[model samples]
Target: MRQSLFVSILHDIQQVNEYFIQTRDATGAPGLSGVQKMTAAFQILQYGMPANAVDEHIRIGESTAIAALNFFTRSIVATYEVVYLRSPNEVDVARLLQEGEQRGFLGMLGSLDCMHWHWDKCPTAQAGAHTGHYHKPTIVLKAVASYDLWIWHAFFGMPGSLNDITVLDRSPLFTELTRGHAHTANYTINNNVYTIGYYLVDGINPVGQRL
Candidate 1:
């Protein structure tokens, strides 16, 4: 990671929760500091390495490394969910529309796609239920992201056998739009004005798709 960016995250995380503070151990020696914990967590996440693979390098036990990862993820979510993971508001809608216009997609709010993440630890008995095209147990993740890389929507935990169409059938994004409470955007292109926004989706039928 870049030095400046890493330092910024360390400072922000410490600001969010004091649990990340480094202090003395039971023997009056300096214990694991927040920097060590964050390092372990980032390594595990960025490399997708086994939890134990980080123990020796980070100077932490396997269990402690895992704990640091959990704590770090939870802290980030708790501290930034409202700003980063929230549904788009009116202001956000306007900004997204402007961005779309600049990119020649006047009515586009974001792109949509579904991915399958293999579940390595899936039980044998439950494997058949989750096995899909990849011939392994997995879970589906559907996401809608804008040009700025802001994920406006995400739905996970679906059985892997389900295709993108089936996943869309169960997604709440459509239901919210149908209820008429979703954020609205208006834009003009080629002397045409459009009120409803659309998303660029991949490998899915658009029968009941949502933006």
Candidate 2:
């Protein structure tokens, strides 16, 4: 590895590390036992190339490389919505709220929509959801975000095998938040303080409080 690789990687991994604080530490997890693992994850997400390329580039195994990529990909989902404020203890729930306010999109820090990332192939069982639903296979990332560029929530790993709206409805954020159970210890959001209420900008979802 180049000397600068770790220097750049260490910084990125630390943020991801904070998010994956080992289940031992406050339910934070997808933790890494060694720097190599975080390094591997960073390389995958930053580059988005196949895992083999990362493994060969870093001289690690294909499985290890794939695992690392998966870790960070989820890490983005887990932490993207959280905003660190002035103090470590203070996370600004309204951190991004200001942007929407200024943009005449007040009371909106998050947008309710489904974005798709293209995929190459669909598996046998999974093909049902992917068939003609989209022109191509895609992993749908359904998320809610604030205007300050802080993502307050995300639902990931929905197989390209399905429609964006269906995936969103079944997303953990949607189910729990709608049922008013989102704040339960087993349920969640950034800072774990979210309630039955979550903020999202409306588009395509024409009903009251859509997923």
Candidate 3:
């Protein structure tokens, strides 16, 4: 059964766009371009076939199909970064913590878990990395906290191939709080260090920071 998660994906993409429209001044020009279309055509390649099949399914010329997939992939990746690639706002975190404390989340404004997103498999790369050791190749990760949980801050995208530990290693939050000499701005809350909040929760991998 060939199902299009297209509508759902588009909805997610729009959520990211809405973030920019609401929080920051709109910059740059209008919509996606021709090359972007090619990128979008590349999306079907994630289904485990080469370009031609995707083209046929979409009823597009080979080239045109490639263009759309290419466009969509790049634009979508950018959209992910735009929507999810940062920390949640302090205000949002505070509100969530308040509600969660009452609900048994217990200072649980933050959350952490692994997620796998499907993607195209590389020629030699084992399907395991992409598919969670299963059928489809995917980007896997442990994501902590959601934009919905936090008002002012955002959580962004990690590549499908990354585990939670790797994602946190590349995170800005870790560097600011745990690495090097910690400073005042490291834990700023309303211009005064907020001590009430609990720490971000993630993995207990050997690579993770130990208290």
Pick the lDDT winner.
Answer: 1
For model 2, what is the error of residue 15's alpha carbon versus the real structure, in angstroms, after optimal superposition?
10
Whole-model lDDT for model 3 versus the true structure? 0.49
**Order by lDDT, highest first:** 1, 2, 3
TM-score list, all predictions: 0.78, 0.52, 0.47
Comparing 1 with 2 on lDDT, the higher-scoring candidate is 1
Report the error of model 1 at residue 74, Å. Answer: 2.7
**What does candidate 1's lDDT look like per residue over 7-51, in tens digits?**
888888888777688989789999898888999899888667778
Top-scoring candidate (TM-score): 1
Question: Where does candidate 2 have its weakest 10-residue lDDT segment?
Answer: 84-93
Off by over 4 Å in 1: 1-4, 42-54, 62-67, 187-194, 203-211
The superposed Cα distance between candidate 3 and the true structure at residue 115, in angstroms, equals 3.5
Estimate every model's Cα lDDT from 0 to 1: 0.82, 0.54, 0.49
